[model samples]
Each structure stands twice: as C-alpha cells, then as structure tokens.
Target: MPNSLNPLLQTHFDTALEHPNGIKKLRELILTLAMQGKLVSQDPNDQLASELLKEIQVEKARLLAEGKIKKSEALPAVKEEEKPFVIPKGWEWVRLGEVGEMQTGTTPETKDQSNYGKFIPFIGPGDIKNYKIEYNENGLSEKGLEKARLIKANSIMIVCIGGSIGKVALNDRDVSCNQQINTVTPYNSIFYHYIFYSVDSPYFQKTILQNAGGSATPIINKLKLSKIPIPLPPPAEQKRIVEKIDELMALCDELERLKKSKETKRKDLHQSIITQMLEADSQESFQKYFQFLTTHFHELYSVKENVKELRKAILQLAVMGKLVEQDPSDQPASELLKEIQAEKARLVEEGKVKKSEALQPIKEEEKPFVIPKGWEWVRLGEVLQKFGAGSTPLGGKSVYTTDGIMFLRSQNVWNDGLYLDDVARISKSIHEKMKGTKVIGNDILLNITGASIGRSTIFPLNFEEANVSQHVAILRTFTPSIVTYLHKLIISDFFQNLVFKEQVGVSREGLSMTKLSKFPLPLPPLAEQKRIVEKVDEFLALCDELEERIGKAEEKRGEILKGMVNDTYSRNCI
Candidate 1:
C-alpha cells in the first residue's frame, strides 16, 4: 500500500479490532464515498447522468399524459449555490422531486375499527431498519387504503417527524405508512437502488437533520424534503457503486462477527481466571493463579469489563487474607479488639456515643472465609465507636441552601470514594440540629438503604465536617486508623453479600442498623491492616490506570474513525 493510504487502512482496521461501533462508522464511510461518485471509476463510454435525467423527465411526462399520475407544478431547477460540492464529469445535480413521484402518508381514524385489518403492511419510522422496511403486522384494510396514501414498491420512505426523524427505508412489497412518513417512487425503475443509496447516505442524513436542532419534535415537510439535492452518477457507475457498498457492508458484518467472537473468548478467559483466584483455598494454589494473572495483566486487562472483573477478585482476595503475607511480629487482631473495646467504653462513659445492645459472638460456621494466623473475625458492632443513620431535615429539599454544611446522601457515596458533584447542602443550624448524623474526618459512610445500598466511602480527613441522610449510616471506628481498612472491607464482595441478605423487613431492600452491626468482618493485625489497605489501594489504583488507558484509547478510536470519515467525505466530494 502507498504510505498515505496505508495509515488510513490500518487505522480503519485497528478501529474494527478495538471497538465494535467502528464497523458501523466504516459502513457510513462506504455509503458516503459511494454517493460522492468516488467509490468506482468513471467509464467515458457510458451514458451520462444528464442524458439519464432527460429520459426520466420524458417518462414522467408520458405518465402524466397517460392519466396514470396527476400533473403538479414544475420543480425548480438546481442552483449552483444550492449544490454542496462539485460532481465529477458525466454526473449531474438533480432535485429529488424532478425524477420521482413524492407522496406523504396519513393514518386512518382509529375509532373506525373496520378501517384496520391485515391487508398490507403499514410502514412507520420503527419499521425502518438498516435501509429496509421490516414488515410488522400493523396492516391496514382495503377500506383504510382508500383513505391512506398509496406507496408503490421500490419507493424510498423517510421519517419526517419526532425523535425518529430522518429514518429511511426502501420497500420491495407494496406498503402504506402512517402520517410521519414520506415516500418517493422513482419515475424510472432503473434509478431505484441508486436513489435509495443516495437518500441513505450520511450526507443526506446530515442535510435533513440540520433543520431539526431547535424543535421539540423535529419535522420536515414533504416539499422541503423533495427540494433536497442529489449527486447522480451514470447508470453503470451507479450499479457498480451499489455493488461495492454491498461487498464492503458484508465485510463489515464478517469483521463484527469475528470481533465479537474474539471479545467473548477474552471475557470468558478473563472471568474464569478471576473466578479461580477467588476459589483457590490454599495459599500455594492462590499464588499460582495470581502469578499467572500478573504475568499476563496486559492481555487480561485489555477490555474495561475484564479490568472490572479483576478488581472484584482483588478486593475479595484482600479481605480473605490472600493478597499479602502475614508477619509473626505484628500484634494479633484479638489484642487490638481488646483495645477497641476499652476505647468504646471510654466513649460510652463520656456520653459521646450511645451504648448499643450486645451482639452475638460469631459461631465457627459463620465465618465467610479463613484469615491469617495473626487475624481474627469479629462482629462489626464490636469495633465501632458510633453507629446511626440521620433523618431528613424538615420541609425536605425545599429547605436546601446554595451552600453551607455539606449534606451527604446515598448518592454521594461510592465504593471508590465520595462523589460530591451533586451533594446536597444545608444551613449550619440544620447541621447542628442533626448532631447524630454529623460526620468527621476518616469516618466510613455506608449507604444503608434503597438502590444505593452497600456503597461506602471514607470521608476526607482534610474536610472540616459533614452530615448524612437517613439512607447513609456513619461508621466511626473506635480507632481512627482502622477507617480506611474497614471501608475497603465493607465494599468487598465478601461483606456486600452479608449486607444484601436477611434484612430487617420483608423488602430485603433496606439494611437496618441491627443487621449491619451483627455482620461478621475479618479483623487483621493493626500493622497488617495498614499493609492490606496499601496493597488494596495500589491494586485499585492500577485498575483505574488501566481503565483510564482504555478510555483514552476509546476516545482516540472515535476521533480517528470520525476524522477518517470526514476527511474521506470532504476529499471525495470537492
């Protein structure tokens, strides 16, 4: 391949390799090039499009004189300024109405049931798919056909109203459509395929769609649509162009099938590897799987969905004590639990936090997964200094202010962190009134109810203060250092499964404080907890970086495909 054309072809192929929609864009490029008279070389010996137009005009005049069609006012000539780009020699600029019989369709009155029956397919915007009319069972009776506009076979139908505007279809069988469609029956049968392809081009789509910007429901009348210009090629060239379009589209279909097949295998391989890592019971087996995964990280993490699955496995492994090794020198978690209890007692005595009901000791079978030698499992209630959800302020959202104290809701919390883009706010007085819900630095906020249930985040330490809504529970550890580790634990699949089961009520949607407190959580050594947090954060940060690269690749893929199409269209046209 020549140097200039080689890169375009490689980008085009790479686009299909990387993303599924790239093929769809490629199809658009094909249609655009076809319509621009650049898809096939011109044959000087072939009859010119201007001569074809003359024959089409003569056919239209004969049909009018034969009383087969009504004679309407003459269509205006195509102006030089109205033409979008220069056409090649032997091609001609022509108005859509100059060579076709245009008709707008209408629906019959719905109250008359007799007007509707299975007689002929009633084409609508929804019936148009990939440039062909899909024959839905919305047929009309003979009585309805009398009231409806008759559309001949091989007519190009286009939607002219609402969100489905600019949808076009070509029908081979006789059909009638609803009021939203306009059909053009070519005066000469030879022009049907080429005319359909022209109307289906991205250029035509843009021409009609540009008028739609400001309307609530976009619309273009039959007259305006008929006045649009078309670049007509000689009949032989038109045939060759259509043939090339079909061949290229078939290749696109093959590319899409192969891409999807390869993608499915990658996903299955990626997920199976992740599942094995999660299921491996022994340290040796887990290490084997982890090493294989790490060695092939680039291959496994190529797709965003694959990276997401890997993140889940990493989180589960972190909580299960499989991510890092245990050090014999670190303090055992049982010792730390005693200290947390002593701190909790001090808070209770200070009257700073309410003394909660005692939780049942975890039975041996209740443990979700085995922990390292230095770790112990404890009820979530045992380690917390405070636990409660807040109430919605009086008057609800009407009382919300532009800015004051940050009011955190379930929407603001995510597994990764707090997203305050749309966080609600309240006056300082309201924050003061809602003392039970006040949040501090390093506090773990958990969404306890509704669709956002189970999401948790650690409040930023640098921020002064914030408050929570009824759906979000404030989880303050007896020791502030445990906050980050606990937040990661709460978001892991191991803990989320507990949050979703056996709720306070039959709904199983709202997680009560009782259920949350009784939940079993693995407690690692203080130093080990820090290590686990660091390792987990590092893994998650890597996942984010991989996703960022994928996102940038996707953005570049789109820009390259679009630039290729636009550049090809511009260069081919002028």
Candidate 2:
C-alpha cells in the first residue's frame, strides 16, 4: 500500500478543496484504488469467495426444491482471462449471479389513473433518487399485481432501461417497480448498503454498460446481468471500507459547505464594498472606497461571478452619473431631447418613418436612480424614430433559400455585438416584399422575448442589409451619440431586472413592443453619454481579463489534483 505522506496523495487531498472538478476527480481516484486492490488490505483469516460460492450453490438447490424461485441453467466458470484485476489472498472474483438472484418487475398493460390508491404506493424509475426508493400514491391493481413481481424490503433495484440506465437504489420498504427496473435479492447476510455502494461504483457502472444492448435506451437482460463479474471482499473488510468511505465523504461534504460559505461571504463583501462606493456622500468618500478596492483587487475579485457583478456595478454607477465628474459647460439632455424630436419630425415629414404615439411622462416612482445636473429621465420611445418587432415571411420554404437575404434571429444579438455566421437567408423576392423590416448599419437589435429578453447588439457596417426575426425588435436611434449609451443601459442589471419584473407569461416571460417603447431610460447629456460608454467599455475589458485569468488558474489547479490522484494510485498498487 502507498505511504500515508505520499506527496501525490497529499497534493490531491490538499488542493481538492479549491479545484472545481475535485469531487469527480476524487470519485475516479477511489475507483482506481479499489480496482488496484489498494483500498483495504486483505485478511488471510477470512473465507475465500470460492468456498462461499459452494455454499451458495447448495442453497440455490434447496430453494429450487422448495419452489421459491425458478431454476436456471448452470453458468460457465470464470476464465483466468476474464479476471480484470488481482484480488487479495482470501478475496475472490465471482459471477454476480453466484451470490444473488436478479429479476425484473412488471409493467401493467392496462390501468386507470383514477384507481390509484394511497396505501399501495407504485414505484417507477422516477421513484428512485440518490440510491433510495421513494413511493408515490399510484398503485398497481389486483390484476396489475398479478403481472408485477413483488420486491422485498432491503432488495437492491437497478434501473436497467431508459434514460437512467445503471442507477442503483435500495428499497427500505417493500415495493413493486415497473418493467424498466431490475431487482437483485442477495442470499448472503452481507449488508445490503455495502452491496449497493459496490455496484454503484463507477467501475461497475462502466463494466455493466459495456454489455447493455439497444441503440437508443441501452438495457441489460437478466442473462447478461447474472454473468457480470464482481469482486468479493471479507464481510469485516466490507464494513470497514464502508465506514472509511463515510468518514471521507463527510470530510468532502464539509469542504463543499466551507467553499459555499466562503463564496457567500465573498459575494456579501463585494456587494458591501460596491454599496459604499455608490453611496459615498462626497468625492473624498468615493476615492477612499475606490482606493481600498484597487489595493485589494486580487482578494476581492477572484471569482468570475464577482467580476460580472463588478461590471454591473460599474454600469449602475455610470448611469447614476457617478463614474465621471459632471461638466457644467456640456449641453443639457433637455436641449438634446428637443434636437432628437426635431430630427424625428423631419424623418416623419420626409416619409422615411412613421410617427409613434405619445408615451406617458416618467413618474417619480419610476425613477430608479437620481440623475446628475444636465441629465433628464425620458421614455425610450421619445428618442427613437421607430421601435417595432420584425415580421416573418409567410411563404415558408419557398421564401427561404441557402443564400439570399440574411435573416437575423434573437440569438444573433449578443451583449457585445451581432453574430452573423448562423443567420438564416431569405429569398430576394421575399426581402423586397418586406422592405419595412430591413435593418441598416448601426441599427440596434434587441431580444423582446424568451430568456434573452434584454440583450442588445449594434448592427455592424458589413451587414448593412438584414431582415430580423419576429423575436428581435429593431431600434433606430434618432441621435447617433445615444445609441451606445442606450445599448449599455438595456444591458445593465438595473434595467434587465425591470424587464424581468414587467415580463408577462406563465412558461416564457417576454417583453412586448408596447412595453419596450414605454420603458424608462435615464437620458444623460449627449457628450456625457459618449464618455459613459467609453468608460464602461474600458472597465468591461478589465473584467474580461480577470475572468480569463481565474478560468486558467482553476484549470491548472484541476490538472494538478488529477495528476496527484493518478500518482497516488500508481504508488499504492506497486
């Protein structure tokens, strides 16, 4: 066996606390050690599994005579080549069928859902969770029970078919399962929990799955299952291994809880720091908090989630007019709004765009943040020439072609920009008929439905002519300077939260065109808007750098842990 202070194992144990893939890596190491016969030492005094097999054979004959179970054909002895690993002196590798009988439960052909009673809880694959059998109110009728096989308490159930193939559970209470499950009734007095843990091992799962049939839902027939090889340890050793595993697993659980607590504390601390910065009474207070954050940047901004939170905080600060000092010389947003109105009126008179309905004035309750001097809160509809969703071509396949007109879907619009690679193409004839829905360069695209409700992207100059899907809404800004600022506002956490709150639906919440037009926007002065966009972009780039570094560090840590586990197993086996 490996030494207690083996550097490799020590490294695995030490670093596993922080590695993201540590649990999976630890499980793999345990299986590797088990397969190498290094998990528990062999006891020479214990009876050999070969001798136990003889006793089982005699017991099987007795059961056959009593008509307790059906007799089956004798299985061939395990060949030397069939042995995958070396076993301890007293332990042996034997067919699973030698120690237990494997049988499948029945699925009723006809059953009324209304007839299901409370007492007889009918179990299905869904009833099994985390290696324990749970019962539901559904029950098998008398006729159904006749077809179904009754499984005794303590019997192990294995999901032999469907999506959950290889999942094993133990029935603490007598239960009946559907056709998809196989039940194993152990003849020996070995703890059923030990057997359950053994078969649930990743090694056993992989081996059993290899022989499973079917193209879609793989299944293990009774014949194939009975022939599966199982490693038998001394009954005392089985108990000891289970106890050791329990102790180690408790340690892992504690580590996980500690990690979660640490993350929660970090998130709380980040929010606290941001709150102090945002709520600073004066420039002096802001500088103090900012300096503290910058000094302990590595400690405060280690997690990717924290970096994303930081980006959102930056946007909140920018729109609230806290990012940069407000200049008294700059033009006020009220004057800028008048210019946008004049521009829209000119477009309407020129027959370039249709006039939108008047929106309600921003209410006192609707103001999310205090605006700086020269800034004004206004509806998004007041600043845009047109805000509406696109329409789909009704001709279906006839109107769609491999290469014709580019159709922009909701997915094409990302937070950063538009993605054009997978954009669908529509026929030129169809594009001509839908001329009003055409998207131009610098036009902002926003998702108005589903999970990506508030995502916005600017149309690139390269794709000047593109038709958007119904899910995407086009916003033609009346002023060029405000487009980037508006995009950033929509992408901000405060506005996104508002979108989610106002969204209407049971299954899929969505923002309608009517809602989009009326959504409140914090309008900064035209020059200030430009400055805010520039500063947000610069900070976002830094967030990206931090995220990339954290990801690489996590990956390196995982690799080190995996290497340690492998080295530990190798030394232990040798």
Encode model 2's per-residue lDDT on 66-97: one tens digit a residue.
98878776777778776666667666677777
Number of backbone clashes in candidate 2:
0
Off by over 4 Å in 1: 1-11, 65-72, 130-132, 363-366, 500-509
Give me the candidate number with maximum lDDT.
1
Q: Which stretches of candidate 2 lie over 4 Å from their true place?
A: 1-9, 109-121, 137-146, 275-296, 348-351, 354-358, 504-510, 558-574
Number of clashes in model 1?
A: 0
Q: What are the Cα lDDT values of the candidates?
A: 0.84, 0.77
Model 2, residue 434: C-alpha shift (Å): 1.7
TM-score, predicted candidate 2 vs. hidden true structure: 0.89
